[model samples]
Target: MTSDILLLEKNMHINVFGLNHNTAPIEIREKLYCSESDVPVILKKLKDWGLYESVVISTCNRTEIYFCSDDSNNSEESIKKIDAFLMEHFGVALDWLKNYTYRFCDEEAYRHLFLVASGLDSMVIGEPQILGQVKDAYRMATFHNTTGFFLDKAFHKTFNVAKRIRTETRIGYNPLSISSMAIELSKKIFGELNRKKILVIGAGEMCEIALKYFKKEGLTGIFITNRTFQHAQKLAEDITGIPCPLQDIPDLLTKVDMVLSSTGSEKPIIDKELVVSIMKKRKNRPLFFIDIAMPRDIDPEVNHIENVYLYDIDDLKGLSQQHLSDRLKESEKAHTIIEEEVVKFSHWLEQLEKNPLITHIIDVVEETRSNELKRMMQKMKYVDEETLRNMDLLTRSIVNKLIHRHISLIRQNGSPSLLEIMKQLFKFEEENEKEMDSGNEGK
Candidate 1:
């Protein structure tokens, strides 16, 4: 195979091997999840291990790794290596991952990632959170120098395509999110959120979005708290609410009817004992806790307490599925947009595949034409400039027409055999030059 064709083939082997809501339950996903700070460390480790071009997208619903590892085109071996890396990082065994993981290769992997970034593959269809998470993963990969040219360009293109999909289609028509779905489920238990007091913990993106949904539903009292008191104070100012210092959470918990926690803390912030004490202070009234953080801010065991309803990220997936079923029409529209982008990018890849052969052909033809023109002028130096110009234009037209079909063919398929054949047939080297000189001598 020609070097150009070989290089293209090598780079085309993209693989996505990881677990998502479809293949794994929340328990498994949570185990596989990485905190945002942990993203760069894992990506750099992959780079050091030679899985250089890769991105890891970890959210409450899914934790997937997309990488290019085409060292020998052994897809099985490449996937195994990736799984082993995940096993080491997440402490999940490779055999266990086989049951809870889904794998996509080449174009399938590309389409899957596009769907994910477009929010079609999210637990909450059309949620805008996934796009930001996807960008964060790409950014982390870039910062760690783990991504190569193909991955970097592909990620930027993916972002553009995702934006187009969101805009051109009715997918985000209602603009629903996981946070909104959490509110929807809460309404089932608490009746109406407008009358209920809410406490928003952490001023991160997830927390910000959830707070917006709650505010839209209307609030009796809004309170914001963060590890950084200034961030909470800023968010509270914008929303016209109270900002409490982190130290005041135990006191604040008793005043709020609903608590939404989405912090980056590695451990549970509200244990069962803490929440139990807070419930008694509320006169045993119903208090709902929604823990949206991956590591979970509210203790799962808190659900055991009387009049304390605690739901973590996993509990809301069922609610999100309801949103997905309701948004089928939007999903179809988004799929159509993604399909168009796939074809466009696939064509671009085809052109990239043809670059080397195209360059070689152009170089030979232009060089041969230049040498022929110099010979014509060397012996006939007295010739007029216009005549020389006419000769040059005539040669250029012939080369353009002759090469046009090959370019068209490459755009369609760009097979390696065709590239090799073109290289052989388009040889304008020494023997052909000698033949041309002989023909001139005869003339």
Candidate 2:
């Protein structure tokens, strides 16, 4: 049992695969992006193909999948399947996959996840949005029943570590998000957003957050629009903006000085033709577009038009450099905190890995004792209640005494050969008997 537990600990490993902003360009990342609705299908496929647990975290900056297999021997095969699946499903080129995607196993994997959860790995280092994104991804995995013991522990610990970073360091102080960065770019494009009329497309969280920043900058006209008009109205009511219908986008584009768009749409919301026509209506007024969506809400070609400026999610990376430097010291502290938590988590997981085998050993021994006692009682004639209780207690005491050393050895140290001997003594499964016998024959 001791050796088996040790083997399990050695065999079980957490793995992570996929690309982030650092590894891949926005174009490559977007190709590999998995929407919230698309995650369950991927998770199910991964499980069907031998992954024990899985979670997919798909944000504008990254699309990473974390998973584990039941055995280490199967990990390579599982990773190959994942690579093939991601490439085929997303239509990613083989060269792109090799050039862009990253793979990490065990300590490296969880460390990457920890950095991601704590926002240290974000394009805007120390941004708080990635933590929430990680939580949402984990929650989605849980809802789909893809997460079990390993992932549950890893993610819960990640949350705690993120919270610790937030508490201990000033990393999250002033919290720079993609929305805040977009607002900053807008300020740079058109100085002083006060009294500026900005049309915000999509009333999602990103839009709401950017609107708050805009409101703080004293923006007077904030028009919110979405495919669902009610959602637009709700967000506009919350943010003190005017609610506009999706159909009114072209007309609104003619009026606003700037447009900030973030929607979950698969295709570009505003094309070059529409923007070109709107530019004519505005009489070549400098209209800036900040697209904070994954696939991008505004067309990239819109930047070609005279007096039109377009910035997608990747464009914000350059703007965040100064912000990243500002939080460098705090980020260092956060990294230190994450490393400490990673070590602690590794220790806890090791101890946890031993528990199942230990429990199974005790259960098997106890069952044997219980069955023998039942047989002995059936042969006896009319034993008193007190005697029967004493007999049960006697058997339990012997069983405990017999297995105490085995449990202690398991808790302390275990060897492979000893584990095999114990497995035979305790009548463990015979699946490996032939292999063991063949090895013995060579001796």
Candidate 3:
């Protein structure tokens, strides 16, 4: 882990432990949700406890803790402390949570972070939201110089990798928007959306994006309703649709051909009984329902109804998987770009390793020449101060010229083996000088 490889440096001392969507259900995820307001307090708590440097990234899909320290012996203890803090804060049992958590250290942690930034670990492959969330977390960690040299470099590299992924691959092309996929799936079952009277049950961002796709597909006779009638009305006007109050959803269900519901409600908005009644009222007409909410706005049992098609978030996972497979095929090119970047990063790390030693040697040589010239000037006091200064400059220039070729050779051709030799040589010289000084001290 060279100093020049910033990600490795920052993460070289970092320990990460967290649970993500793959390991936890919505019930568990909701419990671990740390609001934006809680970030500063959490950081302060970690720092106060001697964690020193820390960053918390809590999102819908993942919650990760990245903390830095020099104490290897306390690494496990620090992770345990973090786990205890989360258990206390979220009121979740440590037994239930521990199984889902993954702890990474050093180079593995650095690689995992890079993969996360590249969007390879996202629930929705190539989703753009995670990168923004990561950037926000990075920005928050920058306060009070908590980021340091390693984190600063690692994050910048992550951002650059994200940019390269976006540019070099078609991973983002033809992305399966949740709303658009719902409409497209409906079309597959029942022809075009032009004649369908679509009813959106909430005015959430997902519902809005869905509506935009529907409108673009020539969808008309749209109706929107929310708990807050004003929000529903605003969304309705924006899409040139009808606005209804939340209570009217039961009545609206029978009239509309398609229903898209995404509310922040804790319980199901549309149940099996309601859909069964609506299907009866519509005289066997096909009805499509999409529940894009976390706790699920629609009941899973609604799928049992005849002529009723119900799709929840989990249902969309299959479609997302298909899109991800397609994106993966395109990602081969992006992986090539990443490989090229890794090589470039490795070369830079090597150059940085050679720089400090060269600089130290140059400084030592220059200082020696300066001291020698000062002694010579004192002995030949008749020489004018101007002439003495010129001689001093001339000697310094001569030393620099003599060392330039050696410095250039090391910078251009230095390997790990060569660096090891240089380090040993420096150590030997220092040890020999110390021995000589001890001998003189005895006299």
CA RMSD of all predictions: 16.0, 15.6, 15.5
TM-score of 1: 0.51
The 0-to-1 C-alpha lDDT of every candidate, in the order given, reads 0.76, 0.79, 0.73
Q: Tell me the TM-score of each prediction against the true structure.
A: 0.51, 0.53, 0.51
**Candidate 1: deviation at residue 229, Å?**
24
Pairwise lDDT winner, candidates 1 and 3 = 1
Find the candidate with the highest TM-score and give its number: 2
In candidate 3, list every pair of residues with a backbone clash.
Answer: none
Cα miss at 28, model 3 (Å)?
2.1
Residue-level lDDT of model 3, residues 26-139, one tens digit each, is 788888888888777777778777775677888989888787654333678888888888877778898877887888875556556766777777887777788889877877
Selected candidate, larger TM-score, 1 vs 2: 2
The backbone clash count of each candidate, in order, is 0, 0, 0
List candidate 1 segments past 4 Å from native: 1-11, 71-73, 175-326, 357-443
Question: Regarding TM-score, does 2 or 3 come out ahead?
Answer: 2
lDDT tens per residue, model 1, 62-114: 88888876645456876777778778877987777999988887677888889
Instruction: Enumerate residue pairs that collide in model 2.
Output: none
Question: Which 10 consecutive positions of candidate 3 have the poorest summed lDDT?
Answer: 1-10
Q: Candidate 2, residues 1-443: lDDT per residue as tens digits?
A: 44333334444788898799999999988788898778999999987876768999999899989998656446677778888998789887777888898988888889999999988898777878899899888877765667755776688778889899989988766435677777776777788888689998888887777788788988879898998999999998898889998998899999899898999999999999998888888999899998988988888999999989998888776656555666887898888888898898888667656555554566577667767988998999899756775675566557767787886776676787777676766665554344434433543
